[model samples]
Target chain A: MIPASFDYVRATSLSHAIGLLQDDPDGNKLVAGGHTLIPTLKLRLASPALLIDISGIDELRGIEVADCIRIGALTTHAELLASKPLREVLPIFHQAADMIADPQVRNRGTIGGSLANADPAADWPAVVIALKGELELAGPTRRRRIAARDFFVDIMTTALEPGEVLVAIHMPRPNRGAKFRYRKIRHPASGYAVVGVAATLCLRDDIVSEVMIAITGATSRAFAADSASTHLIGKPLSTENIAMAASLTGEQAECLSDHYASADYRKHLVKTEVSRALASLNGA
Target chain B: MTDHTEELHVVTVDVNGVRRTASVEARKLLVHLLRDDLGLTGTHVGCDTSQCGACTVDIDGQAVKSCTVLAVMTSGSSITTIEGLARGGGALHPVQAAFHEHHALQCGFCTPGMIMSVRQMLGQNPNPTESEIRHGLAGNICRCTGYNNIVRAVQSLASEAPRHD
Candidate 1:
């Protein structure tokens, strides 16, 4: 598939990218991995006048593993899956990365592109939401941070302002005693999640101290199952309670339907995968 | 070499141990650059939608789907195609030999891309189990239903000396 002709400029630095976007926010689209944007362009779904290539920026790469985890927006899925420090600190990342497209796609598709694109089936939003990540945005004038919970608006929509670019994601490492899990039913052809659920639970003295659950691929946008999560807090960590919470997932959101899966089936997946994810951590 | 209405980009790359440069349009795909401009047609394009791995090639050290990659974005990178797999003496790559010995192909249309992906999997993990091999080859589709032999071919290499990718 061939894309329409468009002007391309490689952004030399983060500020350069911000400046380019600020100059032509509506006409230019920033490309890091180009895995998502190039396909959309090839299909003529989007035809911007210019493309600012942010893949070459040195500042938008690497993972910092300290008390607070910092991940560059351009960090590829392979990098996340391969980082021993990241895995040791947060296993949810590699778990989600492992289920993301194939090895070749992972080698090229960046986390920033995946999140910014806001593809319904993309895995990072739910993972970030469950882990309570803080997305850092850089604009021409200033920098701001937004919680992952408030970042996503809808499919292909984000809270990012015009002329702003997502630069990094910062989040405190989950407590050492906490357990995290991400589970998904993979679509055979596309490798996207039919329905995916990411959950984090901290159990102390046989009681749930903290819990977060986010469901993706089962709604217009990824959403935190706040009711379900709240139901589990201060309760006994039991399979029955887990199942009850899983049943509450996607209770408010309307799911999207396509040739691959129906909305009803996706709803079924939310409950199934959530229960499975929570059950996986039941013994731990 | 020629530009008309669209803006052109100057891209340079090392392919099959040779450094080559080409001026292409901003929309040109890496697969076309290799086949049309650089004359390395061994890298096939089966599914242009990026689902199939026919256009798989080694970019730097990663096996990437060339159809999904823009030529201009890959400037200054090293790319290796199926044509580069043969040794200096024209000997087939060990994976290719295994495929040939095991009759791992039917129509052979997916052979080059499949081999490239297999080389990548083996490069990452010298000895992968049956399920891992299957999972690793999930992205590359062989329509001839020759997956059994292909799996066996990959399995046969596990007993040999570790291949340095």
Candidate 2:
């Protein structure tokens, strides 16, 4: 399926790309790995008049596991899977990347594009939300960061403003004692998450100090399971508490239904996956 | 600063051992560029949507579905298709030889892509177990619905002394 005709420009730098989008944001779109954009174009879901290719911009690529974790928007899924330091600091990233499509897709798919695309079933949003990450956006005149929890607005939509390019993802390095896990039921064909649940729990003296439970692919958007997180905080990380926390995620939102899965089934999977993910973090 | 003026762009890719160039429209996919322009037809297009790995190729030492990439985007990268897998002396690439020895192909339509993906899979993990090889082959699908022999072929190559090729 050949995509619709469009002019393409390889942007030289971050500012150059944002400036290009500023000219005609509606008619122009940014292309990093083109894993999602190309498919969207081929499906004729979008036919931008211009594509500002940011793949060559060297500044937007890397995984830095410093005091604060900073991931350049253009870092590929393969890069994430290969980063020994990133795996050591936040192995949840490796878990998420491992469950993504196949090796070939991972080689070309960028985490920035995945998050910016905001596919409800995309694993990055849930993981980022659980990790308490922030997204850095660059526009023609200014730059700002938005929390991942609030960045995703709806299906295939994000808080990204017109002419603003997602430049990087930021997260405070997780607490040394925090437990991280991402568990998902992958759709057999697409390898997309049927329902993905990510858990990041920090235990202090056997009580939850910080906890986040985020669910994806079950609702109109990836969302933090706030009720579940609230239930887990200030509580022991027991199997019973985990099960109760997971149960709250089922009714957290009215799940969306498609030919692949019904609303009830997805809701059920959300609760099940949340329980499974959180329970895994209880002891180890 | 990028030139947003032109509709046609020039791309140069080193395919196999040869550097090939083409001036193509921005919408032209890399698969079309290879199959239509350079005539490296071994990279099949089983599904153009990037799901099916029939169009798999090595781009900068990574397996990528050509259908998903714009030809113009890979301006100076090195790409290798099944046609490029053989050694300089025309001996079959170990992957191809393995497949041949294992009788891995049923219909042979997905053979090229499978071989290419396996090459990259092994490159990343020189010694992969059966489960690992199966995991790595998640991108390629045999319409014939058989992967036993293909897995065996990869197992044979993986168990051999790691080759630099």
Candidate 3:
């Protein structure tokens, strides 16, 4: 379980991290929280020459609620759970944060690290994709923003380019009368989601003004259930319509099958979890 | 390939209210640094993959899996292991006393982590319900005792008036 030895350098600042990554052409990896990277390293699945510890970078820490909720990349899950502003403004983040692993793991797991790690079963992806969050990235040359929908490319893979570091996560303010929920069937041993669903609904005068349903742990990566969301929009929030929408989840995606659960079972779970999420929102 | 062992990083950490500095490899986990280097073996390493909470320790007042944290990453932070729970090495901490009184632990492999986790839980919510205690201890697993006495132990502590400090 011992990891491969590598050089460790704590980045003093955001730009310094990018500069170190640029200077080290021998696979320099940015580590935050080390919840995901350390395990991978111990497994010897990856052996980088240098590890850039961005956990110490003060600029990459804290939650700022302005026009949007700007969450620094190094903000831990414990911080997210404890944020009073997040709990009042966007309770869904707290809901998801509460279910992420347990207290010990959550104390060290970072939102940016989770998003960048892109674990198929990670809870943040479903919530971020459903909330339409944006990821801010900084590189040696310039900085750019990537939508959550496009940030996760595949399992444990993201659109982060070489020498690029994820700086923050930007989430638009939830619309008025917006109700959100995240429901998941977690694996008993690891606490990872066997199937997770996050739903955001904007209801106006009892009619669904907007809806977004993101499904995770059932496909290669977390993705918006377009068919489900489209079906629920402009329709009255009813059990029948919610059931219809829930059935549409994972319709277009290639559901994953493994020792944890079968593809058919996971697809079934997607429908069940989506229905439960929608039902909870409807009841709210 | 370079000889990675030749590269050692000096880390200064405050463990159990004591400041200690050590030279460790870049890949040295915090659990190994505490047990192997600082001689604080109370933090047991059950599952190094961060699944089991036997390696849990308080890092900067937060419970974290030490096996998943590199020693170099926690160089400047304060860490509290199971050894730090008692004052003046006299009596067990309140949580530890509760566990002992309730017979919460059968085999002691997971006791250090369980005690540390409960200490944190009680710190946050001095009076937690039975369900809350179960949820709080989800990260720490115990093969023996079946968690009945463990829940009772935490419940007994909660039944007492909330104690601050």
In model 2, the clashing pairs are: none
First chain TM-score, candidate 2: 0.98
Task: Please tell me which model should have the higher lDDT, number 1 or number 2.
Answer: 2
The runs of at least 3 residues in candidate 3 whose Cα sits more than 4 Å from the true structure, single-residue gaps closed, are A24-26, B1-5, B159-165
User: Given the true complex, what DockQ would model 1 score?
Assistant: 0.49
Runs in model 1 lying further than 4 Å from the true structure: B1-5, B87-89, B159-165
Residue A24 lDDT in model 3?
A: 70
**Higher DockQ: candidate 2 or 3?**
3
User: How many steric overlaps are in each model, in order?
Assistant: 0, 0, 0
lDDT per residue for candidate 3 within A1-284, as digits (tens), equals 89888988998889989999988745788999988899999999888889999988987889998779989999999899989988888898899988888899888899999988899999999998999999999988999999999998899889998888989999999887899999899898878899999999999888999999898888889999999888888999899998899787757657899987999989889888888999999859
Candidate order (lDDT): 2, 3, 1
lDDT string, candidate 2, A1-284, tens digits: 87778898889988899889999988999999999999988888888889999998988888888899999999999999889999999999898999899999999999999999999999999999989999999887788999999999999999999999888999998877888999999998888999999899888998999999888899888999999888888989888898898788897868999999999999889888888887788777
Model 3 lDDT at residue A237: 86
lDDT per residue, candidate 1, A1-284, as tens digits? Answer: 78878888999999988988888788789998889998888998888888899998888888999989999999999999889999999999988998888888888999999888888888999999999999999988889999998999988899999999999999898887889999998888787877889999999887999999998888878889999988999999788897888777756547779998898888878888888888889875
The ten-residue window of minimal lDDT in model 3 chain A covers A246-255
